[model samples]
Target: MTSVGTPPAAPVTAEAPMRRLDRRMIWVDAIQMVISLIPTVVALAVFKVEPRPQVIWPAALVAVLGVVTAVNDLFRWLKTRYRVTPDRVEVRTGLLVRSNLSVPRDRIRSVESTANLKQRLAGLRVVTIGTGRHASAGEATIELNAVRRETAEELRRLLLRGADRPDDATVLAELRWRWLLYNLVNIWAFLTAMFVIWSAYWLLNNFGVELDTWVLGLADWEALGPGVTIAVATAAVGLIGVAGLVIGFVTEFWEFRLTRVRTAAGTALRTTNGLLRTREVNRDDNRLRGVHIGEPLFWRWMGAADTAVISTGLAKAGMGAEPASTILPRGPIAEALRVARLVLGGDDRPFEAPLRPHPRRALRRRVIWALNTTGALTVLLLWLDLTVEALPGGLWLAGPGVAPVAVLAAVVAYRALGHTVHGRYLVTRSGLLTRSTDALDRSAVIGWKFRQSLLQRRLNLVTVIATTAAGYGRYKAPDLDLHDGVEFADRATPDMLTPFITRIPPRR
Candidate 1:
């Protein structure tokens, strides 16, 4: 097969080896087969009165899928080849259409290891090497599945040997049992719970079983008023969400650890977490564009927040939106700030600087947007009330109630609008319920984009977006006075905006 880069050729030197995954992967595949069938078996036993063909067909289909996966894994194991050199690690796989994946030693952003119960029992772990390349989900991850624990450890050492900091690494934060409670307050935990609840209901319904009996538990439908029934159902759904949050957090953050190591290359930020399937990721500090501190309303009330670094080449999947950037999982603002400073190599001015508030027109604009959104909902509700006979009476009232909420949100949004340039950092703070403060490094910004809508032009408002290769690419200071926005952009990156901006002074 071809080398990682399209050079003429490179031999698989014995310094590493051209090897397949551990033979134990066969057993891992077998365990997966059993795991896949568990839900079907439980459903068949729980709902015995359900149609036999309906339940049996699903189980058969699952079996077919399992077999396909098992066959694929087997062939994959047989065909896969991996070799590590001083410069790079490459993996070649496929029976028909071959693919070679490689990560250069310098470009390698993270090397992660994971093992489920089955893999652990089989003395194997999954090793993934990441280059921090901007790719779709799973594209950046190079997996060596079901490898021996010793082999995995050796690979980690080889990949990270010269990457370690010349100075001692700092331990920012260790896993704390008390801090896990913060997970419950996160919006994602509730969203996941809702998805699970929906999926379960859909599956049961498709199988000709009513979930209302299980969830509502034989409530007297006629005796309970509409509001009472709705309240009960909501409570039941919330309980399910709570259960899901507990399970999810316990599994994901079992022994989470975050560290910052000063390496020869730069400051290396490393994170290891997850219980059932443990994961560890390493990223260079220099790649970090800024820090994204998130404080959801509930967590904010509790004086807790989540912090993630804004960095390119980091995968923003599997955990949350920006998993690689996450420094403090869920902790006090003080703790998050401490970690952020460590990641930024002792630069604390960004966090300490006072932010400049946006113009009053910014607030007006926010209120107008809010009114437009709520007004649209009100119209939709009115149309439904008149057109749909089966529509709920409460929904009509709900539309009007949204007006008060929209107004409150607009005020909060106005309060949240602020930005400032602190030395080398261009900090922008926004969001109401999930307040975010992005402290971006000025040097990382490659370009600027100035946008003004018709309404914004009338109000002399402009949004200056700093474009960088890292993090989310475009970090904005939105709803600023036109000149202020342009000045801020020019100040943040000296001489970069001079060519694009032309100022005309007012005549006396």
Candidate 2:
């Protein structure tokens, strides 16, 4: 990729010609219209009768939908025009509203292109140009739904071209089929499968199908017994859940490839993946301030972790919906960390430097909170028993048992809390179930906030949150020793937090 320089605002001249979307967009729209009109076709055939206006209504609706869609798409193609100049990309669209959007070359954070099977065959792709603005479609900016693949690449190259960095491009990581097994550990998939199973049972039953004798009936509870029946049902649900995750990973990361490219401006990170909808995302290296590496309990044991760049334009850390932000999929933890280092301009300085831990009182506070919460639940259960007089025999015991579990989890969390300043990064690690280590850029720290609870104030512990305009805005180093927290903040960004601190002389 070529390094870009700030070019003079060159007007759209004969040499720099404006371009339109692929003319084939009309056919794509027409095909979509026909698919949508399937119900109408079915309705027409089912209610067919000679001289019946009602039967003809479905046909008329289909025709109207198809014609309207085709005409609208054609008009849209004609109205939408984009131009690539030396400094920026300019797009003018809307037949009536007439809105023009411009993205400066310097500010272009990422240019992502995706193409479905049909689009791939036609050499057309949807390109989304991301600036750091996180808003709705109107503000999140440029989106070209149906552009020629070659033209989209040219736009990507032009928009993301930056100043040449010293290092050459390198391949960071490649996709591995075995790593996909780690994707199955995601709990969301199991929950979804269970929900779907229950929903399907309800829907089918409501439509007069006897689920008890059809689907659910397959489990012969009488012959298998309760234990066996439950085990079989659990296995089936687990299989379904695993299947969903397998299908999802297969389609999303089929031929995944990640590369670090050197450009005139800086290092550029690019990823190309997906089987159903092939996608490519190019991100400027400078926008990347930090990295969030996640290690879920199961995946961690499997020696796998996922890493996402804590960049400005991308979605917040831990929001797994945005695949573009993920630098490494389910891979070895070491590999994820290595890739993370590469993205941070080969800064291998350990962000997980020895951290100043919170006081023991912080752990005490957690224990107290957990016990109180469970105690309240126990009281509630007792009150219910007194009022209603009908309750499960061991249900009340569960309320008290929860206290120990909560305290154990809290103990683990207390141990996990740690923060440190490493080089130019403000690193923090926390969480019990799913541990997260974030190494945010000190330079990216826009503001600081000090928070204290009633108990925290008495214990001289405070939660200091470093605020930034990028990725999850606020990251907290919670329950820190008051003096140490302030000192750490001041050191992280000199003079920023010092004004708030005042020294008190020793009393005689």
Candidate 3:
């Protein structure tokens, strides 16, 4: 991993373990059998269709292929080993495709691991080594199926560095429970949405009468009362919400677990207690990077928060393009912030002064957005109105309704574009109710850029963006910042506070 802040160097070596991962992973495949239906009982009574002799042999051949693959995986798992030297980590794998994977110690970005439900029961694990690139997805870097809990940590420690820093230890063991509940909230939302959907289906089935396809196509808004439109909209939103929850529940269920990890490294938080696969990442490169905390109104009320670190890494097979950002989600600010601080050792400055965005700027942004929304509404409303004129309206049935609502949305978005940067830390957020802020160290910034279009430049308004790789995200002083509030935008501002602060080159 090359650090722009730190000088680049030859790829550091890591002592490759002879076999960091156990070969008993066949156990994981055993679990999959339940899902594959290899037994092929074939609901004979229900289908009343017996297998034809002509196709039986082919089906049997396919089943044999699956069993053969599973067997091959078992043998490979049993033979694979990983060993790490002071300079490089080596992985030996494959029964047929013979290959040796060697990654340097310093080249490792971060280490992550996971265990599926069956793997968890068997004490098996998967590891991912993030090369900080898109090409290193194969082999998962290292995978140990059914290894002991302590062994995984020991290997993790050696792979990251050589020393396990107590002060930097960051192990998350409760993601499964937390993620499960989070998915539960989504499921409830889905169920709630179903009521609205089923209601819509009812309306369409029972009330969509005397429909002429041509009339439906030509329908314009000048014909209907506003009450019916509102009801339909409300129903539509409710149904969508329910659909979201169902998807959340199903998606969250995939290979979920709290991970365990301990690595010899810069920041400690990279070590997670449990994950289905092994992963390595670069913490030092992104040490100064920051994250934005966005807790929805509902989650906030429940005293929970979702934290995400922004980075530029591409996604892997299971590695999210922004895995670091999404996986770093911490809880209640107190706990989350503590974890963040531990992981980001250099970032501890508190909020001293607040930099707020200009109200007029936000308002202008809102007005422009409102006009566009109004235009969309005009079209929708016009079409609905024409359709409604032929049917007896249900409820909340007007022309003013659409314009007022569209304009209101624009106003709200404009009003929502506000930010507050405190002391050396900046929290710039702009969203309706779900605003987000990029929190990071000011002194560590590599450089700052202000960008705006001609219209914005003429308005004397531009976005102030500061960046750092250690930082998870880039902070933006949009619309307004310290300039309006008597603050200076220069590298000197940081050096004045921290003498150790040096000039960081422009981001690549």
Which lDDT tens digits does candidate 1 get at residues 1-508?
1223322123335477688789888878878899888777776677554656766777788899889888888998998999887677889999899999877666666778888878877888999777666656567678898689988977775675443543576777887877767767545655777899778875776456778677566877668989998887677667778788888777878778887776555567888888887877777765777888888765686778888988877766554423566766787888888777777765456877899999999999988888888888888888898889898765767766888888889998888889999977999988887888899999989998888888888788988899987877888888999889988988998878777667522112
Predicted model with the maximum lDDT: 1
**Per-residue alpha-carbon lDDT of candidate 3 for residues 199-247, written as tens digits (9 for 90 to 100):** 5553332222222443346545346657766676566565688566545
* RMSD to true structure for each model, in Å: 5.1, 5.5, 10.6
TM-scores for candidates 1 onward, in order: 0.83, 0.81, 0.60
Rank order (by lDDT, best first): 1, 2, 3
When summed lDDT is taken over every stretch of 10 residues in candidate 2, the lowest stretch is 315-324
lDDT accuracy of residue 218 in candidate 3: 53
Each candidate's lDDT (Cα)? 0.78, 0.75, 0.51
Q: Which is better, 1 or 2, measured by lDDT?
A: 1
Clashing pairs in 1: 132-313, 165-262, 165-263, 309-325
Q: Which candidate order results from sorting by TM-score in descending order?
A: 1, 2, 3
Clashes of each: 4, 9, 87
- Candidate 3 stretches with Cα past 4 Å from truth are 1-21, 27-83, 91-101, 134-151, 163-184, 187-267, 270-288, 297-304, 309-322, 325-355, 376-412, 415-423, 470-473, 481-488, 491-508
* Reference-based lDDT, residue 109, model 1: 67
